[model samples]
Target: MGYSPSVHKFAEGADVPVPLDLELVRAVLEPHDVGDPRLCFDPDGDLQFWIRAGDGSEAEIFAGDTGILVERPHSGGVFGIVAELVSRLGAVAVDPSEGRIVCSTEEYAHLPVSMRKDAVVIEMTGERLEAALLGRRPA
Candidate 1:
């Protein structure tokens, strides 16, 4: 009964540009009353943060060159908060449940056709994540 979040990165290198403004992202998400915002970096060099939502739900967010990855609880308005964050940051939400993508930013329209058709499926492995981001069937 929860939702999974993922980001689409089109570039394949170490110098990918991060699309989100961390300051602004923090400002917008602050209203959600996030607690213990621990900032860190992923192995891929993505900026990441872990926070506890107002409702005590834990979430992890990773800001990367391609887009932002958000993992939040599905309850207690987490979905609404995610939508607002995506809109403010000019990102998109992939709805695996609906087998479609929810575009929240203008950039969504400019994304490549391959990305446009990408669906977000929840999986725990790196290969699955790679496949999902690449718009390819998971092997």
Candidate 2:
């Protein structure tokens, strides 16, 4: 089974956190129309949808106020698309499988990070990555 990776949202050009929701993702992708964002509604705070790649392959997007999760990404181009997608949202794509930020080497160098037990910790919260997503460790 393919694992899910997630994006961390922050203020534009800044490290301050921001809300990540379906509306924000829709707004970022509406004009480009690069992929079809399936629309649905739920009173629950979280939602999921399909994000297609240029090659017609797709992945699932789980979006909520806390964060966005992407799974079963089969296309190479999806990473490129994701980079652009997150950039538009002032966020970063993190690959939990790789335990590193999905970014260029130079960009990765500048991220505020710490290594703990071979785990990459985002200094933003000093949290360990869980299921390829950043999560705070139990206190």
Candidate 3:
């Protein structure tokens, strides 16, 4: 099967709370030995982490108030990593092609019923990063 990249979108509301525990996140990544993950802030002030995979490819996970943005090269193991995160962190997978939430965890059982309209949109781009560092949105 070909690899399909998807973003794990955390739903907002009283029922589906976003996981903000960075230590838990680090713990989940420990088994993979992702090294000492570096934390950074995005343009919108969301927390992000840079993790080095076993194969040395860099994978980025941006933790927003309501969701997480994962950016990885077309490497083979990203899907598994995402799955692991879903299993450990209770994330909902949003299929990139369909632009909808496809799966839910036990903690987010209400997700499937929530529909696509509720899925949070998270965009991570180099221009956004540059603008954030410069303290201005790119024109």
Give each model a TM-score: 0.53, 0.58, 0.53
Model number with the top TM-score: 2
- Rank order by TM-score, top first? 2, 1, 3
* 15-81 per-residue lDDT for model 3 (tens digits): 4545555566556555654434343555677656666555555566766565666654334354455
Write the residue-wise lDDT of candidate 2 on 14-84 in tens digits.
44446765677766544434333445334574665665656665666666775777777654445445556
Report clash pairs, candidate 3: none
Tell me the spans in candidate 3 whose CA falls farther than 4 Å from its real position. Answer: 1-19, 30-45, 104-108, 112-139
Task: Write candidate 1's Cα lDDT for 1-139 as tens digits.
Answer: 5456654432222233346566766676655544454446557766666655555655667666666766654443354455566656655555445545555335445555666555343332333433443355655
TM value for model 1: 0.53
